[model samples]
Target: MSKLPLDPDVADVAPTDSALTPYDNQHIVTYARLLQAESEGADWREVARIVLHIDPDHEPDRAQNAYLSHLARAKWVTGQGRLLRGAGSN
Candidate 1:
């Protein structure tokens, strides 16, 4: 896999591939961040702005879709044995 980006350029909607993609590899950190944010009870709007970089205020539907899809992929990845890059490991 190519070196994972520290910050990925997010799609309007994250990939729909059930299997992992290059996008998945590049976004492992983003996935982890999303899961962490959700677990912390962060608001979807705030998480969307911070993690996905989509302004929910301007585009609520797009932001929500990106947030949910990426979050789902994150859960799937962890369940399928992809290691998270660990908190604060950088």
Candidate 2:
């Protein structure tokens, strides 16, 4: 698996008064699942679209860009997975 990009600022800030918002956590989890399901295959553009859908008002920050790049790289390495699995699979 490719190394996930980390935002230095995110770590720089103290967590005592900081916590990921529900939306943030949701995006993170969705991204992780997308990455894992595709075996690290995820397109940055598609990921960006997903991110935008999650937070339309929020601008694409540095961390977001980094993540998109990472996803693109992963997608390049591995192909996107099947939308549907075997028969009877939900």
Candidate 3:
């Protein structure tokens, strides 16, 4: 995968910066949409393709893997895709 084009602002993380939060709202929404598609038996690779359209230089494999891991954990606890749906509902 090609490297993402760095945003100089984002590249600099101060000790007290709030930008390091693990769950970015936009990222969360993307992950949730991907998860929902997967739950409906949609091809994850296809979802990844669509996601990469927004951030083409993103590491698609990593993003997909993270979303899958999150979905699996949520499924184990909730037995449904509600959490994934909720994440993107806003």
Top candidate by lDDT: 1
lDDT of 2 by residue, 1-90 (tens): 343333211221112213333323223434444467446566544554453332323644644554554444334322322112211222
- Inter-residue clash pairs, candidate 3: none
Q: How well does candidate 3 match the true structure in TM-score terms?
A: 0.37
| Residues 1-90, model 1: lDDT tens digits | 346687786898777776767777778889888888989999999999998999999999999999998888888877767735542232
Collision pairs in model 1: none
TM-score of 2: 0.26
Q: What are the per-residue Cα lDDT tens digits for candidate 3 across 1-90?
A: 333232111111112222322333324444445457777887656654554332214665564654455444434323334344543342
How many steric clashes between backbone atoms does each model show? 0, 0, 0
Give the TM-score of each candidate. Answer: 0.85, 0.26, 0.37
Clashing pairs in 2: none
Model 1 root mean square deviation, Cα atoms: 4.2
Q: Comparing 2 and 3 by lDDT, which wins?
A: 3
Ranking by TM-score: 1, 3, 2
Q: lDDT for model 1, please.
A: 0.82
